[model samples]
Target: MTNPDKTGLKPTCREAHRLVSEGMDRELSFVERTRLRLHLMVCDGCTRFNGQMALLRTAMRRFPDEHGK
Candidate 1:
C-alpha cells in the first residue's frame, strides 16, 4: 500500500491508476499530478500503464481521421 504525504495525496496504486485515467479526459489538479508523478517514479507497472495509455490515446485520436482517408 502506498502512503499519503503531507499533501494528503492518497498515493496508492489504485489512486495512481485513477489519476492517470482521469488525466486523459481532464486536467488534474496540482496535488493529483504530483501524487501520480511520485507514484510513477517508483512503480514500473504504473509507469508502463501510463505509457500504454498515452499510446492508446494517440492511436484513438488518429483512428477517425485515418478511417476517413
Candidate 2:
C-alpha cells in the first residue's frame, strides 16, 4: 500500500506494526524499518503499543518452558 505521513512521507502505522511484528524474523528492508521508526516517533499510542508488544514477547520467551507448549 502507498502509505503516507502528515508531511507526505512514505510511512504509516499499519505498515509499521506489520514490520515490527512479522518482519523481525526475516530481513526487513531499510525502508520498512525506517517507516516503523518514523511512526513510533510522532505517535505515542503506537509507541506504547509497540513497547507492550515487545514486553510480551520477552515475557513469553522467558517462560516458554513453563507452559506445556
TM-score of each: 0.79, 0.69
Candidate 2 achieves a global lDDT of 0.73
> Could you give candidate 1's per-residue lDDT for residues 1-69 as a string of tens digits?
534453464477778888899999999999788889988999999999999999999998778774576
- Which window of ten consecutive residues has the lowest lDDT sum in model 1? 1-10
Residue pairs in collision within model 2: none
Model 2 Cα lDDT, one tens digit per residue, 1-69: 542463354456676677778764787877777777877889887788789888988897878485576
Q: Which pairs of residues clash in candidate 1, taking residues 3 or more apart in a chain or in different chains? A: none
| Model 2 clash tally, residue pairs | 0
lDDT of each: 0.85, 0.73
C-alpha-based local distance difference test score of model 1:
0.85
Write down the TM-score for model 1: 0.79
- Lowest summed lDDT across 10 adjacent residues in model 2 is found at 2-11
Against the correct fold, how does model 2 do in TM-score?
A: 0.69
The TM-score leader among the candidates is 1
